[model samples]
Target: MSFTTAPSRWSDVWLVTAARGISSCGDFLAASALTLTLQSAGAGGLAVSGLLLAATLPLVALAPLTGRLADRVDSRTLLVLAGLAQAGICVALANTGGPTLMIVLVGLLAVGLAVTQPVLAALIPAMVRPADLARASALQQSAGTLGALAGPALAGVLVGSFGTRLPLLVDAASYLALVAAGLLIRTRRGGGRRPGPVATGAGIEARAWRLRRDPLLLATVIGVAGVVGAVGAINVVEVFFIRETLHSSTTTYGLVTAAWTLGMLAGAWIFARAVARLRRDGALAGAALALLGGCCLMVLVSAAVPSALLLVPIWVVGGLCNGGDNVFGNVLMARRVPEPVRGRAFAVYVGAVQGASMVGYLAGGLLLELLSPRPLVAGAGLAGLAAVAVLAVPLRRAARAERDVRPVSRDEPASAGEDAEPGAGLATPVPGR
Candidate 1:
C-alpha cells in the first residue's frame, strides 16, 4: 500500500478519486447555478427548500434498492451508467424552462447520485489493501473537497458571464469525464464474484437485521447520523447568519466557505499521516470524536463573536475536524463491515445520515423563522458534543474488542456471511453457517 511497494496497487484508487472529483465539481456547479436561477425567478424560501429536498430525498428513499444493486452488480458498470444517466438528466435540465420541470430533473439527477454513492463506497476496500484503507480514504476525500472548493467559485464566474445555461452545460460535460474514469477502473465486480440472485425485499430485511445485531456498527451509524443532522442545521442558517448577524456580503460568505474548504484539504492531508500512527481503533474513534466536538465548539464560538473576519478561522477549524472525522468514519466502516454485506451497511448508514440531514434542514427553516441563527448554531454545537459524550463508553469498548481481533486478510475468501463471533472482529466465519 505504500508508494514504494507498487504503483499498480493504488492505480484504481486514484482513478476512483479522479472520477469522484470530477463528479463532485459538476454537482456543486449545478447546485450553485440552480440556486441562483431559483432566486432570480423570485422563488421563496419554501420553494428553495423544496428544490434542495428534491436533490437529497431520493437518496433516503432509494437506499434499500441501491444498496442491493451495489452488492449484486459490478460497481464499475454501475458508476459509468449512473454518470451517463446524470449527463442526460443535466441535458434535459438545460432544455427545461419551468421551475417544476427543473425540480423534477434535479431529482432525477439525485437518483443517479444516490446509486453511485454506495457502489463507490463498497468498491473502495477492494481497490487497495487493508492497511492502505485510511490513506486511500483520505486521498479520495481530499479530491472531492478540492472539487467542491473550486466548483462554486467557477460557477459564479460562469453564471455571471454567460448565465446559468452554460454552467449546466459544463456540468453535463463533467459527467462524461466521470464515465471515462469509471471505464478506466479495473476493479473486480462485486469485490470478486458473479452477480448473485437479485435481492428480494425479504433478503434486504434479513441483511438489515444482521446489521442491527452488531452493536458497534449500529452505534457508528447512529452517532454519524446525529452529527450530520447537527451540521445540516448550521448549513441551512449559515447564509442568514453571515448576512444579518455579521452584516457581510455574499462575497464574504464565499470567502468563508473557501477557507473551510482549505482547512478540509489540510486536514485530509494530515489524516494521510495520522492514520498510520493511530493504529488502535479506540484511539482513532476517540480522536475523531474529539475533533468533531472541537468543530462544534468552534461554531458556537463563531456565533458568539459574530464577526465576518472571525468566522473564517472558526470555519477553517471546523472544516479540518470534519475532514478528519470523514476519513476515520469511512475507514472504520470499511474495517467493521464484511465485504458481502458492505453495500447494505453503507446503504443504512447513508440513508440514516441523509434522512437526519433532511430533518435538520426542515427544522432549521422552521426554527429560523422564529429564532436567531446564533442560538441555532450554538444548539447544533451542543448537540454534537452531547452525542460524543453519550457514545464514549460504548465506542471505547468496541474499540478494545476490535483491537484483540485480527482482520481477515484480503486474499482470504470474503464471500462468507456475517458469521463473526461477538468481539471477534468483522470478517470471521460463523462456526456452522
Candidate 2:
C-alpha cells in the first residue's frame, strides 16, 4: 500500500479527460433525448420521474459492490468492459419501445456509470502528484461541465430533426472514446496496482482507511449530501417556475441552463488556483460548504426573478460556486483518503450524493402535485442553507479535533491513521471513502 505513483501523467490524464467528456456528453444527450421522447409521446409526470429514477437508482444502490469492484479490478478492464456494455445497451435502447423496457435499459446504463465513475475519479488522483491535484480535478470537472453544456443542446437539435433514435445512437457511439482511452492511456490502477499498497502486514494501515473514521471528511460529506438533498428538488421545479411564473420562452430557459454550465466551467479553473493555496483539510471542507451555500442562495433568488432571462446572470454566479465546490470536494478527498481505498471512498461519496438527489427528486415531484413552483424553489434554497448552517457545528468540531494533532509538511508522509492530522491528510492523494 505504500508504493508511490510515477511522476504526474498529464498526457495520459488528458486521454482519460477527453474520453470522460465524450462519454458524459453522450449520457446527457441520451437523457435529454429520452425525456423529450417521453414528453412528446404524452407521458405523464410520474413516467418522467420514473425515468429519472431508473437512470439514478443503480448508481446509489450498487455503490458498495461497485466500489470494491473498482478497487479489485483493473481500470483498463473496467473501463473497456463497462464502456462496451453501455454502448450495446444504448444501441438496444435506441431501437426499443415502451416505457417499461426503456426504463430498464436506462437503469442498465446507470449500472455502467456506477462502475466507471469511481474508476475515473480514483484514477485521476493516481495520475498526478498531490501538487497537481487541483489542476487535474479542475480539468476533469471542466470537461464534465462542457459535456453537460453540449449534450442537451445537441440532443435538442438531433431529436427535433431526426428523432430520439439518432441522438441515442450518437450516445452509443460516444462510448467508443472510452474504449479507445482504455486501450491508449498508460497509467493504470487497481487489480493490485502499483501505487496502492498490497494487503500485506504493513499495508494494513492503508486498507484501514474509512470515511466515518475521519470526522472532517465525514462531516463534509454529510453536509454536502444534506445540501444536495435539500436543493435537488429545484431541478424539477425550475422548468415550471421559469415557464409559468417567469413567463420565459423555451429558448430563454435553454440559455439560462447553458449559462450555469458555462459558469461552472469558469469556476472550476478559478477555484482550482484559489483552493490549491488552502492547504488544510479543515479549510477545504469549509470552503466547499460555503460555495454550496452560495449555489443554493442563487436558487433561492431565482424564485423572485420577474423574467427567466435575468436568471442567466444569477445562475452564472450559482454555477461558478457549484463548480468550485465540486473541485474542492474532489481535492479534499484525493488528499485525505489513502490511495489504496480511494476508489471505494469515491464510490461511497457518489452514492451518498446520488441517494440524496433521489430523495430531492422524489420530493420535488410529490411537492409539485400540491404546491406552487416558486415556493418550492425558494424552500429548496432555504433548506440547503439551513443544512449548511446545521453542518457548521460538526465542521467546527472537526477543526478543533485536528488542533491537537501534529502538522505534517506538504512534503511529508501520507499515512491515513486517525492520529494523522489534516496537514498529513492534505499531503496525501485523496480520501472519498
Candidate 3:
C-alpha cells in the first residue's frame, strides 16, 4: 500500500492513536511526578524500587487474563473503563500524601494500563485494511513516541513550577480526554459480541502451544524479547555511564535521553514510509532486529568515544532502530495472527518483552557490581548481536514459507478447522473442505 493511501477508517485509526498518545503522556507525567514525590519525601531506595515494582510487575501477572478479555469484550468499552479507572487513580494520587497510599494508587494505575495495551494492539488490525496495516502501525507508534518524548519534559516543568500534585491532576484530565477519544472510535467488529469462554490455565497453555506452531510468529516474539532483554541493561547503567565514565552533568543525561526519544520519533516517521514499500513478513522483522542489534553496538562505541557531543547522535540512531523494530514487530503480529486469538498472542508477546526486560534489569545490576559501565554496555550490544545471529536462519526460513503462501481474504475464516493449528497451513484450506 502506498503511504499516501487513506483508508475509509483512517478516522478510527487516528482516534485510537490520539487516545493512546494522550494517555501515554499522562502516564509518563504521573510516573515522573510520583518519583519526584517519593524523592522529596526522603523515601529510601527500597521504597522507590517498590513503586517501580508496583508499576510493572502486574503487567506480567495479569497479561493473560487481560488479553483474553480484550478478545471477548468490546475493546472500546474496555479502553473506556481502563481510562476511567486510571483517571480515578490519578485523582486519588493527587490527594494522597502518604507513600504507602501513593504506591497503591500507582499499582492500580498500572493495572489499568496493562489492560489497555493488548486490547489496543488487538483493535488496530481490525481498524484498517491489511494493505494499510503497516502505515497504521507506524502512525500509532509515532503517536506514542511523540507522547513519551514530550511527557517527561512537561512533567519536569510542571513539577518544578507548581508541584507534583498539579501534574497528577493534569494526568487525570488527560485520561478523561482518552476516554472521550475511546468513545469516538467505532469498530466494524460489533461492540457487543459474546466473548469466547475465558481460557483456564490449561487453555492458556494450549494457546501458547498454538502460537509456537506458527514458526514465523514465534520467531518474531523471541527475537523481540531477546533484543529487549539485551538493550534493557542500558537503563540500569546509563546514569553511571553518563556521570562517571563520560563525566557529564545531569543536564547532559537528560539531553541524551531526549536525543534518543527524538530519534525514535524520526525513526517512526521514516519507517511509516519505508514499510509501505517493503514486504511484510518474518524477513522484514529479522532485518529490523539486525538493525536494532547494530544500534546497540553503536551504544558500545558511544561509551568509548571521548566526546559527549558524539553520544547524542549515537543514541539517536539507537532510538531509530528501536522504533523500527517496534513497528515491524507490530505489523508482523497483525498479519500473522487470526483475530480470534490475537489478544492471547499479544499478551504472550508483551509478557515476554516485560519478563525479559526484568531479567535484564536484574542482571545489569549484578554485572555493575563487578564491571564498569563501558564493558556492561559493550556486553549488552554483544548480547543483541548474538540473539540476531541465533535467530537469523529460522526467521529467513519463515519469511520464505510466508512468501509462498497465498494471502487469506478478510472474509475467510482464519482458522481452517477447530483442530487446525492457526497459521500452520497458510497456503491450504481445511482438510474436510
lDDT, residue 141, model 2: 64
lDDT of each: 0.65, 0.73, 0.64
Q: After superposition, how far is residue 212 of candidate 3 from its true place, in Å?
A: 1.1
What's the residue-level lDDT of 34 in candidate 2?
82
* Per-prediction TM-score: 0.80, 0.88, 0.77
Q: Which one is best on TM-score?
A: 2
Candidate 3 Cα misplacement greater than 4 A, ranges: 1-7, 32-53, 94-104, 130-135, 159-163, 188-191, 194-209, 243-252, 276-280, 305-309, 366-375, 393-433
Instruction: Write one digit per residue (lDDT tens) for candidate 2, span 1-433.
Output: 2323468888987998799789878987888678667756866456666777787799889999999888889999999999999999999999998999999999999999999988887787667765555456556666767887788667767877788899889999999899999988887888867453444211235657777777888888888888888888877666567656777644455456667777777776677666546666787789888998998898888888887778888888988887778767766775566677877888888888878877777887788778888899899889888988998789978866775573536853332221211111111000000
The 10 consecutive residues of candidate 3 with the worst lDDT sum are 424-433
Q: Is candidate 2 or candidate 3 better by lDDT?
A: 2
37-96 in candidate 1: lDDT tens per residue?
665566544555566777879888998998888878877788789989999999889888
Compose the digit string of candidate 3's lDDT tens values, residues 156-175: 57776788889899899888
Query: What is residue 276's positional error in candidate 2, in angstroms?
Result: 3.6
Query: At residue 429, what lDDT does model 1 achieve?
Result: 6
Highest lDDT scorer: 2
